[model samples]
Target: MANNPFKYGTIVQEPYFTDRKEELATIKESLNSANHLILISPRRFGKTSLILKAVHATKRPYIFINVQRAVSTADLAELIVKETLKRYPLERIKSFLKHFRIIPTISINPITNGIDVTFNPGVDSNILLEDALGLLEMVSTKKERLIAVFDEFQEILTLEKGIDKKLRAIMQEQSLVNYVFLGSQESMMTSIFEKVKSPFYHFGQLMHLKKIPFEDFHQYVQEGLSAVTTESNDLAKRILNITGCHPDYIQQLAASVWDLLNYKKLDREADAVDTAMTQLIAVHDLDFERLWTGFTKNERRILRDLATLGKLSSKDGYATSTTYSTASRMLKAGYLIKTETYEIEDPFFKNWLLTRLS
Candidate 1:
């Protein structure tokens, strides 16, 4: 067990080790009652990690599938079959292949000793979906429950036009398997699940994953910092204040501080922390450039205004103004986050903007 407290931009699955206990309990309760669920959050907010943890804690057989790269029905079916067969025995897999009407072929490599199972596409794509559902239903019958989590579920909506309706129909017809649709990109996710006119409307429980509490984070960082050097509370607060409870940024900032501590055992005046923050921003220069590259001139100007002035509203305070509308759209797209007194998104980018503008 290393003394590392930051799991930057990665999934943490250990129950006793993670901090989202209440969210896990809510998911567990929903799964226990056979309720379908949709977990939503912004990018990098630990949705995948939380879903993986929930599936691990569940009292049923579960299959996890990542469809972020899937573009068609064929891709979706292939990924599902591949993950499902990984847990079954050869004989069972062969038996399963018969239900799919596709032969299960295995390949052996003499050099690497790696085995690969290849699935022959059946006569039609519908058969693939049917067989997948059948396999899940069969497993659920014998195992009491079966949970299938589709990560990056919003991508399914982008798959051809009618695919969303088709997939919804398949899930709606299922009586045994429980689905956990997990996705970031809050606006798209809401459109998929919350729109009354959509096929997936009212299909599952909506759950939003929030950032880890400040108290929990403070304790975690304190323990990690204590292991290296005796830093003051003010230093830790300053670091967190800049990161604003973003898990990835917090971990990254802490890792930078640890690297500084490695060189000099202690620094109590906070210069090391400040230097680490500066280096972190400098190292991420390309990220801001990429973000700016994707924006229109007006959008970029709106962002620049936020970066310079900290918040924005119409000069006339009218909701119908172009400024208000543009700002609202950017907020929904996750380009800006509106707080009580400020509008800032991506703390690192904000800091970078201040430095560049200054």
Candidate 2:
């Protein structure tokens, strides 16, 4: 059997990457114009993959950092420096570090042959962070324009009070590099970039990423599945409907369906879809259970109501202020999303909850 034609849970490259022609063009144009970009999207919307593709299309060297991975200001500083070093040699970065007051202890990891950087304990990491940004700007000036992407940049708010100010200050002075800030949390990202009182207000061109259109996504999935299944068109529509064209889940569900049709010898397309959905829920059963248990009694009630009602509102047994508050909190935490009305984000989770409740 041919290998699965779908991919998820990591950066997807060409052939596997679906249509984002317009978004890809816009990002390349922004990069070429040296405009800093702020891209906002909910989780699993393919923001990272789209940005990386644009950067690669422009053939520019990039430093990509997942801000969520950093636990503290110091860790963030080290991450920036380490990514910079990966793209350049230590000899080149040494001169830039000399200008800063706080010099980090840099060593080579014998196992990975990668650089490991650390600062002394009790050092003011905010200062170290500032110096690190300054160093990046300095190094970028010596070469072609660099693209520095900070994924989940809203986490900076939790790292330090003034870190946003420090970042904006450094970014304003940077001329040779194009900065791309990606965020998953809509409210926090808006608070950082859109609000007037925030340090990054009017800092860059803001772009809100949305889900792939159903038609385009359906075509991609259809083409991929045609390699293995004779019923590609019907199966493609089922996958899109199941995933709501969510980039990550679409690929994930399609992969499962492909495995069933190719390896399991499933002759009926409907059975493949049903079997894939069942398998997906079983695989994520533990995660869903943990999430369900983590919620308060009120939150779980709201989840059940949203799944049953299809679109939740105060008229649908949510008359109390406490219940509304619980739904609001769930929305903020990304458990629910609002379109025409509020609904659960994960379709499989909703399916599991419905089965359990029934």
Candidate 3:
């Protein structure tokens, strides 16, 4: 039996992985250059995958922390130290951290068998963050190079004011450590890194990852299905169009298509895709409904306009219900993304929305 050519719902590696060659190269260069970078993309654009690939490619010892999983400043502090120890030697780490006094009280985490770096919750969160940065800086100097990737980094905005400034100040002292701040919340991330008021203003190189081009996505889909049947590439292109080239959706839809064809022995490729798409939308129905409930009446109208008109100002524009400022806010909030013009970021959401609004 042949292997499954598609992967979804998790990180796809190697032959299963499609593109992002340029992104992979840039991250490697940044690792060597100590280039702090924030990799921003809408969810499912494979930004995290590129970071992981670079971790393996770069010679520098690398640590990856998912910032969203951490709830408090202490959690963030504990996370940094724990992930770092996974790569560095324990005694050497303890010896190095002693100089910075980041984790003065260390005890083994009974659950994971890893040491937990405890700090006083009474202390200012900024101070705790500062100590964590100090520890990373000391380790970087000792190791010659250390790269830390903070995924879902925009969650830091949930903290108290000036956390951005404190972090920027902390990172500035580090000479050998490279930081990659990866985020899906584009608006929040923009405020943190692009707004002049943001302490992270101009702190790193900005990279806005674009959706996969039709040619690459189309060709990749074709290649993946090549072994199963002598199907037309047109069927693959339809899947890309259906998913708007959203990497995760494309992979998910494609995986389902492959299964219907190979497992259920569907005849026509287009029929198989149609069945797969129905299943895909059904699976995502609850998620779409949850998103629907979060919007205001104006935002809902805007989505309806985007679906029918494909741009603002058809039948009812945002200008009618809300100001252009509101539209801009939505863009920053990641409810919409602008390409040739503004549209719903999730193609599937637009489809579901049109059904309700129409």
Highest TM-score, which number? 2
Query: How high is the CA lDDT of each candidate model?
Result: 0.73, 0.86, 0.77
TM-score each candidate. 0.87, 0.91, 0.88
RMSD per candidate (Å) reads 3.2, 2.3, 2.7
At residue 40, candidate 1 shows an lDDT of 91
Worst 10 residues of 3 by lDDT: 314-323
| Cα error of candidate 3 at position 178, Å | 1.0
Q: What would you estimate as the lDDT of candidate 1?
A: 0.73
* TM-score for candidate 3, residues paired by index: 0.88
Compared with the true structure, the alpha-carbon lDDT of candidate 3 equals 0.77
lDDT of 2 by residue, 131-234 (tens): 98887778885357888999999998888788889888878987988999999887789889999999999788999998889999999999988877788999
How much is the lDDT of residue 254 in candidate 2?
92
Ranking by TM-score: 2, 3, 1
Q: Model 1 clash tally?
A: 0
